[model samples]
Target chain A: MMFFEGSEKKVEAVLKPGQASLRQLGRPFWAKMVAQANAEILSSIHNDDCDAYLLSESSLFVWDDRFLMLTCGTTTLVHAVTEFLQHVSQDALAMLTYQRKNEYQAQLQKSSFADDLASLAPHLSGNAWRLGHLDGHHNYIFHLDRPYCPEPNDATGELLMYHIKGEDADYLRSEGQNIEQIRQMMAWQQLLPQFQFDDFLFQPFGYSMNGICGDRYVTMHITPQEDSSYVSFESNLPSEQLTPVLNHLLKVLQPQSYDLISFNMACALSHATGVQAIDHAEQALPIGYQMAFQHFLLPSSQVRSADPL
Target chain B: MMFFEGSEKKVEAVLKPGQASLRQLGRPFWAKMVAQANAEILSSIHNDDCDAYLLSESSLFVWDDRFLMLTCGTTTLVHAVTEFLQHVSQDALAMLTYQRKNEYQAQLQKSSFADDLASLAPHLSGNAWRLGHLDGHHNYIFHLDRPYCPEPNDATGELLMYHIKGEDADYLRSEGQNIEQIRQMMAWQQLLPQFQFDDFLFQPFGYSMNGICGDRYVTMHITPQEDSSYVSFESNLPSEQLTPVLNHLLKVLQPQSYDLISFNMACALSHATGVQAIDHAEQALPIGYQMAFQHFLLPSSQVRSADPL
Candidate 1:
């Protein structure tokens, strides 16, 4: 259970460039907090003004005015939550979406704030849903509305999240064995040529890369360990490129089996938009993978309506 | 690509329960056709009113009033297409969904009707979408609306499909080296307690079972080969219990890598309904899978609308 423990904590914070330069303060600031979270620092890549730190178990990205972090394994990400609040105290926290799975075993209990959901519920102002399984791996999600520090009417932007986790920890690492080959393939594909890329290879276990495309960025992380191998791809660009990006990512990682989850801030009434994204990958994926599971996260208070004609 | 040549031809025909019983006209009818398609028949199992057949490449399921057949490999299902039209002429064909993937190779050209799409396109009425990759494996879907022969609207029910192929199929056969053990596990699970189960074991390569659960039926096929090993689980039951059914099926087949496709005639506007079905199996699936891809087929002309809060 200790080895099986993993979490993906993504915090979206608002920062202003003039106050604290991302290039000058971002990398060092996050590196210290990663250590504070009890996560081993493997490598950190800086591009434009954003710093992407690859931890032993997860990843973190710091931009000029925004912060996004995810950590897994026994890393006490909860401990760093207070630190993040302190560091970005001046900058507003726009949104916070924390997700965790594989939370069934006892050893992972303390590391997972999900274990204390009842207590944590009061502080977080957002919607939460559990896949509802006590004996097996389960998915838990918590989302906070825009303007983390509440304001009358602040609609910064809609944050969309898409994730796919390979079914087995060991299988994930094995799929990432050909990281160099994948990079070469991506280069051949000429994905996002406009961006300046900063890439890093972890000494023994993993690799990571972050591309800065103007103000937007796309980052990828792979932690190829036997006990807990994981790879994550994230971007804040328009949805137009989502299909190709995901297709290339799947080709590079090639997980044997995986589960897909999407949190769409924009409207996608009947999985219509999400389904299109998956369809694009189907053409590129090698035969033999089943999209065994998929989910579109929505607020519990929301009601379903018929698709538009 | 040569080894990747695969096709799943699923034909659905309407037969009346009182006439042309599957048990009476099924086995011999399909056995002869399997030979006609240039595929060898491994074995067949009949239970209650449904018949399940295992072939060198894919599978077949026949019910009292419906027939579902899928064939892969160099089976030349296109040749059998004429034969199927002939046999089901009396029963009347309800619907047909023929899907082919990895069909770019020259060797499979003659066996694939896809090669004659120019000529075939005019005959089929449904919309078609080709993943459109000529050099690599791609998904191509062809669907025809019900009443294969003009008849009144007949809503049989929603059909769900889930399948997985072993990564090193040869390895799966080696693991499945224990045939008797699999049978014992099935027995312990009581997968279909009320129905009489007739199981079949192929000479040296595969295994299949069909359970006739009253009016509903479940069938499974496994061809654990190195180059083209595959296992499929399909059922025509209510969605309420679909999750548990799939869990047990996955456990019995224990496929390392799998693909799932669901053709739901019923409503599942939000992936919310679909996610619930998959969440049921999450607790049971072993590690090492990435749910790599998924697509929800929609009415070709339908448009999207925002959700009602």
Candidate 2:
């Protein structure tokens, strides 16, 4: 399938300056009113493609909702395109190709980058990301002890964020065995897709390769705006005597304002521990202290999903 | 990756004629336990490679508690394999492939009809045929009623026996809604493999020609066997109402032994009446069974599952 072969796109998004301020917007109904929320969700999808994308903007109140948190990062045009076609079963490429021809220059044909991205406009509105949760709990600690990967330079700009819980523990006194397995199982679902392109056609790639397909949890992959050459990001966290879990994220990323936003209460702690533990050895937070980026709360900007071709 | 493709097979066996017999000779747990029944069941394959076959043996239970039914069906192979490797994966072909190969000549290549059957010996065992169950009820009833299918003089020895419990009154009221569907679905699964060949790998010309799948709660393709001809079979039942069902089968198959089986058990009737209506038109029965066969009482026999090649 065309999907199996790595797509023909090579161009990356240009990260512009300034904070992409995020905020929670006022809504007519309570988030807990699932019945009401579902009705709105359906109506939005029925109104045409754009309505579905914008509904999230207005619908989002609990920035910490696991489903919302997974999509916080800047994503690639390629990932975005695939998600839309997969979810909606639409002929996305054709629409995007038409749009690309109408707006971009003929020379762009030298590369498929613009074409690939244009196809994704249908799926991404102002935000492009997903949510993550494990064992009904959002916070799970993890400690990374492995040495930095060699030639890690090429892998830069590539961020590997892992969530570990159970087996990472030193002792299996009670529920330890099951707890560790669940977390690893959850993390595999979150991380593996970024590496595998073949499983896209298969139904969730077996039970082992997937988190439970229940609506309770989800994992996402985001393509950031920068490459590793310009910027790099990494994190380190605490280890334990028994449950030796220290959450860490290493980013070999290009420098830029591009970012991802999603709702995960644990993400706050995972990053916090990493920063605190890393600081125990050296350095304070990056120079600026204006404020930490609040992911769940996006500015009430009424940006619509990219117009459908 | 290829294994993920459903070329894998199930140990399949077909029911031959005569009083149920037992084969005491112990062999590979699969074939040995499959008791030597007077009825002969053959090995059949789906797809080009006869990986899995089917059988009509009962689940493990001692003949009143002697030997165990060690022959594992689809669930057996998949789970055992999962243990051997480390995790259960998805089906490579379809969910399951039931078959019994007659690998008469598992070695040298032969072009004749005899040689072709020999290579099959490695794949199919004499008493193996896969049974695909719906929900979990093995005793299923399908009503087949069509103006008519073109009748030919000769029998297409390949036949399936569906036992029904409908009384004369019930038979008259039968709309045959289910019978037609079950036939179509089973036929399609049998014909569906052709498209898997090299030339039509992407588009399924076979499915289109067959006109099946995509529908729900329809007929289910149960099993396939190696024996293409009929052997003499017997049963004792004399009834006039049953004539239509027999006549119907005669055109499609040369049933060696046509029989009916039934018993009176209290069952509720009427979706609206909400009361247990014990009407003489006994409810429905399994997909392949006649009334005469029901009159005869037989003990559960052994089941042996073998790897048909």
Query: Which one wins on lDDT?
Result: 1
Per-residue CA lDDT of model 2 for A142-259, tens digit only, reads: 1111122221111101122221112321121122234344344334335433222110111221111111111121222221111111111111111121011112222111111112
Candidate 1 residue lDDT tens string, A1-309:
113333455554555335565446645667777777787566766656667666665667776666666665466665566566565553354456555543312233344444434434545555544431211123455555433342322211111222223433344344334556546745623878777666665554455666665656676666555334445566665555545566655545443223343333122222322232221101100111111113222111222111110
Q: Give me the TM-scores of chain B across the candidates.
A: 0.61, 0.19
Off by over 4 Å in 1: A1-7, A15-26, A101-110, A116-126, A130-139, A145-179, A186-189, A202-204, A223-230, A251-256, A263-309, B1-309
* Candidate 2 segments whose C-alpha is farther than 4 A from its true place: A1-12, A15-163, A167-309, B1-309
Output DockQ, candidate 1.
0.01
Worst 10 residues of 1 chain B by lDDT: B279-288
lDDT (Cα, tens digit) per residue for candidate 2, span B1-309:
001101112221212223132122222433432332111123322232111222332122112101112121122332222221121122111111122111111111112223322433443322111111100001111111212121122011111222211232122123442433433422433434322211100111011011111110011121112111211111111223223323443323322211121322211111211111111112221222211111111111222121111
